[model samples]
Target: MNAKSLVVIGIFGIATPALAAAPTIDQLIANPPLLNAEMDRCKHLGMAANDDPRCQTAWKAENKRFFGNGVRYSPEPVNIFRNTPDKLVPAEKQQPIPPAPAGAPHG
Candidate 1:
């Protein structure tokens, strides 16, 4: 083989692995561009987007793929003293100490 043919063959040999490693269609579809385009198109539809079946389906699919069902937020604040038994009750609510019994030997 000529030197040029050998160089071409060597280049192909190196490039073949890279081409083979490229993502498949399903994998590419999961990436940002495809989903982002769908979302952008839906956004362009404005209020009617909610009524569009295609937009709804795409939104649901994207939500499920990226976030599962949905995220839940608690309305109540977290109690930092929840696990501390001693600190559960406020100091103000505790009973006051009684006076000493009949002035028994005033110290």
Candidate 2:
């Protein structure tokens, strides 16, 4: 391959994996609120957000371990890696019920 092409490929190879890797909650938090992960292992394990690299690594590992390979993309991506399994609350946690007025059924 040509020298220029080799250099381009080298750069692309390094950058591609970085982008493809699962993102950390802190990474998502740094930007606007977006997708949520199902299991924030970092916080669950009592790690700091500053430990983002370690978090991402563990997140991917555990994700594949439990759900099998390639199941990393949950309905809520980053939230999974950033919240507890039982308390992985989503935005739609509460459903609105009609408020009962005075003397309403069981009010």
Highest-TM-score candidate = 1
Q: Give lDDT per model, in order.
A: 0.70, 0.58
lDDT of 2 by residue, 1-107 (tens): 89999999999998777545565544554433322342454566565644667566555545554565464467854654544685645686678898976675663
Model 2's alpha-carbon lDDT is: 0.58
Q: What is the C-alpha RMSD of each candidate to the true structure, in Å?
A: 15.8, 21.1
Model 1 clash pairs are none
Judge candidate 2 at residue 78 and give its lDDT. Answer: 61
Cα distance off (Å), candidate 2, residue 22: 16
- Candidate 1: where are CA atoms >4 Å away? 1-31, 69-83, 86-107
Please write out the lDDT profile of model 1 over residues 23-103, one tens digit for every residue: 333443478686677678889999999987767767766766766555466787667676667445566766879887785
- Best of the candidates, lDDT: 1
Report the poorest 10 consecutive residues by lDDT, candidate 2: 30-39
